[model samples]
Target: MVQAVPDPRRWKALALLCGAFFMVILDSAIVVVALPSIEIDLGFAPSDLQWVLSAYALTFGGLLLLGGRSADLLGRRRMFMVGLALFTAASLLCALAWSPAALIAARAFQGVGAAVLTPTALSIVTTTFEEGPERNKALGIWGALGGVGGTAGWLIGGPLTDISWEWIFLINLPIGVTALALAPRLLRESRAQGQRRGFDPLGALSATAALVLMVYAVVEAPQAGWTGAQTVGLLAASLAMFVLFTVIESRVAQPLLPLRILRSWTLVGANVTMLVFSTIAFGMPFILTLYAQQVLGYSAVEFGLSSIVFPLAVTVAAIVGQGLVLKAGFRLVATAGLTLLGIGCLYLTQVSAGGSYFGDIFLGLLVSGLGVGLTFVTCSIAALAGVDEREAGLASGLSNTTFQIGAAVGVAIVSTVAVSRTDDVVAGGGEPIVALVEGHQAGFLAATILAGIGILSALLLLRRPPVPSPDQPPLVPVAEHADD
Candidate 1:
């Protein structure tokens, strides 16, 4: 394991970590509320707008394995500084972007920075706090971040966008700088001992290429016609990359993704449930933001305030969820959480153009976010439950990779369904407002279906949760993470 320096004020360091991590997650969600504003100011085509979000998610998810490994070999604090520099610079570029391509390109760079920054964060936390209850409490707080920090983007983005859409990106500047300044002084340098310095270039290339191609195809398919020649060609190419990725990783002496990791039923179950949960968690917000603003006639500030229940519910539920985990075990808590999430998503279908936020939107989001909070905390624990310290960084990376990738898929698929359904209704001579509301209903209902599958997966397969190690585990192998 990368060695950690003990500091009396580790909690302060944690604050910096959480702040940086919050920006990483916030970027993923903040852009949702800014979608309409960005579209108008940057003049993005409806089909292309999702790229701003997808570009970041695709790169962030794709390169995460490499990033996690790098942190183990290259030094966690060192990589954090590098990543912070890149993320801060990218955020500035995003704020200054003048065109859709420019913004998307900058966003992708931001994704690269995020890929480097976020996965290593848990590593730092684990090392700082030690194993057992202290780490668990820190981890619980870390886990709870999914709700408030992730969804906080929606609430914060609105007020910022009201000033100017650029504020959404610019807001990261101060947070990034503060973390950068504090991290060096507060966060001790750590890396795997006697680690090799070489990287799996081919593995990184193949994985990133595979995810980007797949996401591109998914995002563009509806507009391109699912069976269109271009769509088919991209799909084939993406599949080919996946095949190549599998072949390369298996043969490589030091693979970016060790295929053996998948053998752990504990990690596998946690990842699968995480992927499903994030798919709906991320997508539902995008679907509702559009409906609230365009159809329900809410202003940006109003929408942000009205949506506050989600984060509030999440905060309360996450703290309670940690206690539940200690008492009831992961299996029961996760299953119950997913069940509530599914119910919330189902309730969202009842929303109408004329519905009240207090009665409809607030209730649905509160239930959904509460469940999300509980499940996120438990999943975070379960993901690393059985992992040795040596595999801790990698396991954490895999968990986060699934989440970002799932979110990209969620948004792309849900938006395609909503856009296509809305178009169909408009063609049928339905009122535009009514059509939009129905389209949102379809997306919300789709989240319920996905959540139902998650619940089933949790109930049927998640019987084995990660058991806590009495002591800290080992760090990644040096040979696999040779310094770049």
Candidate 2:
């Protein structure tokens, strides 16, 4: 009864989808390397510069579900074009801005556009490809976008910043335009057919507001003392908003996120595992970038080049990992990957103040990066597996939400620990470089523990699909785990 997508065009659609996905991802990393340039050009105090990242991240992560649901109502292809146009326009705004206010506002607009486009792209892919190894293969490549974008941003940022930081923002314009032009020709419009109501406006509002406040608190907690009134107040308010959101969703007939969808242990397990590993993976760039610049005295270009290994490893692993998942199954491959990641992080604890990259860091980077590569690809497969087609967009949104929220929480927690430890050592009259390296190593030790826990979680919570009895339904419930 299901109509087959035009197979001949699916691959081209995927290339375009990945292209847009890559541009959105680049925004996340591009700002990190270009922060100094932006600070100088926009006359922002260093503190205000955090908003440059925060504004984008909060909006993107917070409203992802709303955007995803919007696509379910508005049609995926339509949403994609609108998002592309909005993001492209916002990029122009970002490039032209002369003030910190203008840039931050523009970044927020870009985030909204990205939040709209991201999950819709995933849902479109899920719909386009058949649900088997074919879908897995497409998803495997789709999974690479995060790392590819990160690596591309790091590699390309230095050159762009060397010319003008504006170029970093400007580069998105052409990519977005091309995607927009090809999208209507290549992508077909699809919406969930049986929805009782179109938009869950209230659900979207509360969720967006709650996430914004929470992410804002997380990003600011280190800058503002963790115990500061602002931090405490913002967290309390965010919690209240979240509670209200739950109540609203429960009472609403047509909820944006039906509470039932979240009852799936399969989706829950996938997201939890993602959170655990992502908490570790997300901090790697921040810690490594800091080490390269603050401790190693590397120039911007050198630091970017050094950071290339992780994404490169992830890109390679994701390609090969599809076959691995097919053979070994999701739980086993993911658990193994997490074990390797834990071991790699434990090994990285050996880094010293004057540690050589070749001797102390590069091997660990390669090892951890490989682990990350495998882990991420499997996580995607597991999350989407067993999800109802109607809620594929929802699942995509939730998966991304966990990853984004996890990253925000991880960076905050790790930064706080590292900064506290470094300050303590400095106060005791330790060399600043030694103190910083010691602090970074301590964070890595914590990351190792988290990664180890993720491995255990995978072993216990994940399972292959049970053989169906003839009396039972053929379709697996969203709550069940199944081999890819």
Count clashing residue pairs per candidate.
11, 0
Local error of candidate 2 at residue 459 (angstroms): 3.1
Q: Report the C-alpha lDDT of model 1 over 1-484, residue by residue, as the tens digit.
A: 3343456778888888877888888888889998988999999998788888888998898888888888776777888888888999999999999999999999999999998898788777765676556666877888777568887888998899899999999999998888888887887666655457657889888878878877788777767889998788888998898899899989987788889988888678888988888888888888888888888877777788778888888888888887787678777888888988889989998889888887778878889988989989888877776565555667878888988888888888788888887888998999988888888888888888889888887876676444545564533222223333
Model 2 C-alpha lDDT per residue in residues 1-484, reported as the tens digit of each score: 3444345788899999988888887877776677766777779864355577667766777778888887776677888888889889999999998899999999889888988889889888887775667778989998887667855577777678878889999999989988888997888777776676466788878877887788677667766778999999999999998998899889888777889987877788888888787777765555665666567776667766776887798898878877787678778888978887888788888888777778777888888878888888888888887676678788888887777666656655565567667877989999888899988887777788788889988887765522335564222112111221
| Residue 176 lDDT, candidate 1, scale 0-100 | 87
Q: How accurate is candidate 1 locally (lDDT)?
A: 0.82
Clashing residue pairs found in predicted model 2: none
Note each model's CA RMSD in angstroms: 3.0, 4.9
TM-score of each: 0.93, 0.89
